[model samples]
Target chain A: MNSSLVFLIVFGVVILAVILIYNGIISRANAAQRAWANVITQERQKNKIIPHLQTITDQYQQFESGVQEKIAALRSALGGLSSEKMDTAKLAEVESATRNLVQGMHIAVENYPELKANELFGKLMREIAEQQENIGAAIRIFNQNVEAFNNGIEMFPHSLVNSLLNKKSTLHTFNDSEAEAGFDYKPNF
Target chain B: MDKASPSSENKQLATFLQSLRTQIYHAKTREDLRHVLHTVRSFGRPLCYNNTSYWLGFSMGILLGLLAILYAYWYPSSVSAPWLIGAGGLTSVIFAVLIYMRRSKVSDLSDALFKQDVYLDNNWQSVPYHGKKLAAQLSRQFSEFKRGNHSREIEWLVKGTYQGTDHQFDYHAYHFHYVDQRQVTSTIRDSKGNVRVTTRTVYDHFHRYGLYLPFRFARNIAITNSWFGGFFSSSYKPASVEFNRKFKVSASDELSAAKFLKPAVVVEIEDLGKALSGLNLEFNAASELCISFEQNICQWQRQHGLDEPDAFLQEIEGDQKLATLQKTLERIHTLMRHSDNNF
Candidate 1:
């Protein structure tokens, strides 16, 4: 009878430990998913500003035809993006394309200073800047959550529990060229 | 109401300061001293209280009087009434004399000299009659003015209009204070081995140097070194990673915040933040720009005696104070010009 009681206590402790670890992993996974949703939301918001840029830049097409064509190609490329299939690689591609679009706008503005005089153009410029800021913020938040999620499944007792019950994979963090080069710090001894 | 120009007002300040110095140095008779005190009081906020030693003396007297009474009551068989009365009476007389001497010293010319020193050091003046209206307008418009749980005060207000190269804007500068009370609970064991629990309310005072620019912004934006600025709704991270790490930017409209914080403006703000800790910048939709930072910015460290003509002259004649004022003005000008162009 005493042995049966000891067996029951150990069984209860193991079940509680597994439950706690399972809940922790699930919470981290949910947080990572929510953060990715935010990134997709910000990217879609950024896409809405492209039409405004096109309208203003179209009037100055004589000065920079190459910029206009690149912006047009970017809009179509973004149109086919599926939120469900969104990953860090696809997000990085969108980010680089957006940067190229902004660079083109800068070039167009430099070629035609008169474009800055238009009130619509000024407003559109501010909107684009805002979108760029939001996208950057969203990506950083997403990467932080992914790091947390990956850490949860890879650390000590959590790793043991994940291996036994929840076979989850580590998530990838989004990396832009600037972030990649900026964060890579190697010291010479 | 019409106001004097900054240059003209500064001239008046210089003239009045010189005359006060001369009067303080030459005063000999009590009447002459009274005249100096009157002039000092006219500048504002008079000191009417006695010194700390006087209060300490009175407190000691009260403690001794209470001890004498306690001794007599507890040891009725040992002490007599006459002895107790004599001790109490002697303590009262000593307390009265301390109060009288301290009051006389304070009422003479010491407070006047202290006030003069403060006036010169801070360049402070009495708030105008319309200052209430201005403070009220600020509380209504800016979120910073509306903060503080216990109390809020705006003092030493100075107003001037700066004529920039392309545009001109009015600025109101003041020292703002906010007080908050926090309750602290403490438990102690006394000499008799009895436990005591005491709860007291302690006050936390926050002092800020505030600059108000009565200009309109297209959108509301707040940037602060802390995440709890509580001025706006949404948080924004600009493209500058350094800025994101040091400061948190929030705005009601992200587009306007982006336009306002151009690269040049962000660099300027970062420099300012590095110079000053606890810096906060707010551009409200009410067409006002409020810049505030923790602690007093203007500091002068020279003191003069009433009879020392050289030190008095040196204090009055030095341009270090004016240079400090101009440096502050230049900083404000640079920030405003950047925001104006970008926004």
Candidate 2:
């Protein structure tokens, strides 16, 4: 109840609040980055399957010229990709090229029943579908983390703490279209 | 294979059960009863205890102890404590005496009769299928089915082939039961600060319908409702917001899990969860597809005590039981198709 005692108690409470909020903000920011890293990992996995797709398609004469061009475009778009930064436009470009190549193969497989039934072709298509699944999951996780981070830095008491100490900005989540495109898998067989 | 039509299998089973009930009622001696019991055992492995007499005795003792506690409240507090203790000892003697009177009466034949009914109803055959082997295999392959101070058994297992439009697979369907035991210790302190520690054993019993299909999946995925979600742990999350909210999905491989849990599969599983509580599906790397649900969709009824010789047999509505089971199987078949249709 004394003046100095009251002052000390108030100071201690304020310091604890600040420390808690600061830790929360830092944790959310780190989680968002980790989720983005996972997305990058899945994207790299997709890239690794491109050569296998080309090889099998070529063997069956299913590789169209347009498909080859899209594969090249995909490589170029993803070549300068870095986990240190996120570029949505470049990611969109890589996704579009990948879709075109997959769709091209789908058309070719539809025209040839034997090629569609080939064991290796079936395995490669499964692999592509698997990569697409992982990519969708990763993107959704990243968006969830981004939403959490934004909520942490923009909410009431946390916002006051963030502005005064951490000075973090709100993050934008991935568009719904990006996640939806990954799930539109159509197998010819 | 029977020359009779599948539609008449139920009526034939019902007639067989009626004759079996008569034989049970007419059996005069323990030897006669044992002969009838052998006839029942030819059907399937019964999930019942032959040493049920011991359980009856133990239960009688507990009942007497509970009555003694009630008597203490009714009588005066000044009543001697040794008298009450002597009564408790007397109850144990009575329990032992009752257990010794078991002479394989018609009443003692309910357990075997129930098993016979289940096997006949499902057209399931009794074979030398080891329950412990399957439990150990499941524990070894899947983290969710890991053995943790639990005893498991699979009984009345039926093996058959299911021919789907796109694939044909062999399936093993059975009754799966496991009892989880935990030791709970509590400390009690009196006004004088004297502490008493007591340890009690607690048991949780789970009865489930389990099916195992030898199908290889791209990845191992575990689907369970929110209630049992904490029991499983995984780094991967489903993309659908509705699924993520309704169920807990996890897998060892992210890609395989996501691919296995397509949007259609997610919706089907979620709807199944709403229909059947405590439903769990696990697809493992060992090419085993295991599905278990806690609901008794088969509607099996067991006679617990000495009623009429035909009490349990009369309750065996095979047609109704098979109809419900078929509906559930169709739903599960739909789920399997949805998972495959992801590609």
Q: Using TM-score as the measure, which candidate wins? A: 2
Model 1 ranges off by over 4 Å: A1-28, A53-65, A102-130, A155-167, A177-189, B1-151, B155-175, B179-343
- CAPRI quality band, candidate 1: incorrect
lDDT computed for candidate 1:
0.67
Residue B28 in candidate 2, Cα distance off native in Å: 35
Candidate 2: tens digits of C-alpha lDDT, residues A1-189: 799999999999999999999998998788778767767766777677777767765776545555677778778877866777766566666677778778877877777777777777786777677567657666776777788888999989999999999999887776646556578775463
Give candidate 2's total backbone clashes: 0
Model 1 per-residue lDDT tens digits across residues A83-171 = 66546777777777777877877776787889779887787676676567657666666676787788899999999999988889888
lDDT of 2 by residue, B188-222 (tens): 99999999999999999877776677656444667
Per-model TM-score, in order, reads 0.47, 0.50
**Model 1 compared with the native: what TM-score?**
0.47
